[model samples]
Target: MSDIDTYKQQGFGNSTGFGARPALLIVDLQVAFTDPQHLGGGNILAALNNTKSLLAVARQCGIPVAHSRNVFDSVDASVWCVKVKSLKDLTETAPASQIVEQVAPVPGECIVRKTKPSAFFETPLADWLHQKNVDTVIVAGCTTSGCVRASVVDCISHNFRTVVARDGVGDRALGPHEASLFDMAQKYADVLSCAEIAAHLRGALPG
Candidate 1:
C-alpha cells in the first residue's frame, strides 16, 4: 500500500467536515512573497488566481473575510528576523509587505497584522472570528509550508473548523507545498480544492 493508503488504514486522514458559518482567511499573500525578485516566484501565481476566485464566491455569499500580513517596523523587534533574513524585507512601510492587489481586502473585511507565523498568535484574530460567529475558516495564501501551515493548526486549536484550499495556497517549493498539504489533511484541516469550496458556498448561501 502507498503511504497515503497506510495513513488511511491507520485512521489518520479523517475529515472534520464543514461547519455552519465559514470565513475566508488569507495569510501572507504579500508582494514580498508573490514577486519573484523579492521572495516569491513559484507556482504562487496560480494559487493567487485560485484564491481570487474563492474570494469572489465568499463575497457574494456574504461570508466574513480576514487577511493576515507579516509586517515588522524593524529587524530589532524580533529574533525571527535574525534567523530569516528575508523577513527584513517585510517592513510596515515597504511595498513588498503589502498584500497583493488581486486579493486585497475590501471594505469591512478584517485585516490582521501579525509578526508571527500563526495568525492567532498575539493577534485579535480569534476575537474577531468570534464576533463574526465564524465556525469554519477557509484558509488560503502563500508559503504553504510556513505561515499557512502554522495558521491552520492554530485555527483548529481555537475550535474553528478549518478548511485549507489546496489550489489556493502555494509555496516557494513544490515539495514543501505538497508535504504541508498532506500533513494538514491528515491532522489539522480538511484539504479541498478552491472549486469544491466555491461550489459548496454556492449551495450553502441563500439567494
Candidate 2:
C-alpha cells in the first residue's frame, strides 16, 4: 500500500472537516518574510497571491479574519532570536514587522502579535477566536515548514477544526514546502487548495 493508504489504515489521517463557523488565520506574511533581502524571505510571491485571493473570498463571505505577526520588542527578544538571528530584525518598530500590503488586514480583523512560532503562544488568539465563535480556522501563511506548521498543530490542539491552504502557505524551498504540507495533511490539518477552501466558504455562507 502507498504511504497515504498505510497512514489511513493506521488511523493517522482523519478529516475533522470544516466546522459551522470558520475564521481565516493568516500567519506571518510580513515584509521581512516576503522580501528576499530580509530574514525568512524567499520565493513566497505565489503564496501571497493565493492568500490574497482567499482573503477576498473570505471578506465577501463575511467570514471573520485574523492575522499573526512575529513581533519582538527589545526586552522581549527571548532565546528564539539567538537561534534565528534574523528574528532580531523583526522588532515591533521595524518596517519589516508590518504585514505585507498585498494581504493587509482591514478594519474589524484581529491582528495577533506573537513572539513564537505558534500564534497562540502567549497571545490572545484563542480568546479572540472564542469571542468570535470560531469553530474552524482556515490558515494561510509563509514558511510552511516552520511557523505555519507550528500554528496549525496548535489550532488543532485547541480543539478547532484546522484547514491549511496548500497554495497559500509556502517555504523558502519547494522540498520543505511540499514535505510540510504532506506532513500536516497526514497529522494536523486538512490540506486543500486556496480555490477549494474559498468555494467551500462561499457555499457555507448565508444566502
Candidate 3:
C-alpha cells in the first residue's frame, strides 16, 4: 500500500463536503510571489494561470471573492521577517506588493493584508466572510507550503467548510507543495481541482 492508502486506512483521509454558500480566497498571488524575477518564481506560474479561469467563474457566479497580499507596513524584528528578509520590501507602495494583473480583484472584492502567513490573523477576512453568509471557502494561491496552508487551517478553524484548488496553489519547490496539499487534504480541507470546484459553484448557484 502507498502512503495515501495507509493514511486512508488510518482514518486520516475523509471527505469534508462543501457548503451552499462558497467564497473564493486567493491568498498571496502578488507580484512578489508570482513573478519569476521576484522572491518566488517559476513553480507558481502554472497555479496562477489555473486560477485565472476559476476566478472568472467565481466572478460570473457572484460568489464572494477576496484577495490576500503580503503587504506589510513594517517588518522589522518580526520572526517571519528575520527568516526571510526579502519580505520587508513588500510594503504598500512596492511593486512586489501589487496583485498580479491576470487575477486582479474587481470592484467590491475584499482586499486582505497581512504581515504573516495566515490572512485571518487580526484581519477582517473572517468577519467579511461571515457578513456574506459564506459557509464554504474555495482557496487559490501561491507558496502552498506557506501562506496557503496557514490560511486553509485557519479557514476550517473558523467553522467554515474549506476547499483548496489542487492546481490553484503552488510553492517554490514541488516536494513541499505536494506534501502540504496532501497534509491539508487529510487534515484541514477538501482538495479539488480548480475546474471541478468552479463547475460545482456554477451548478450550485441559480441563474
- 48-140 per-residue lDDT for model 2 (tens digits): 999999999999999899999998888878899999988988888899999999999899999999999999888999999999999999999
Q: Which stretches of candidate 1 lie over 4 Å from their true place?
A: none
Quote the lDDT for 107 in model 3.
94
Q: Which residue pairs clash within candidate 1?
A: none
* Per-candidate TM-score against the hidden true structure: 0.96, 0.96, 0.96
RMSD of each: 1.2, 1.1, 1.3
Q: Which is superior by TM-score, 1 or 3? A: 1
Model 3: per-residue Cα lDDT over 36-85, one tens digit each: 77767646999999999999999989999999998767542378888988
lDDT of 1 at 148: 96
Alpha carbon lDDT at 2, candidate 1: 95
TM-score of 1: 0.96
Better of 1 and 3 by lDDT: 1
Score candidate 3 by lDDT: 0.90
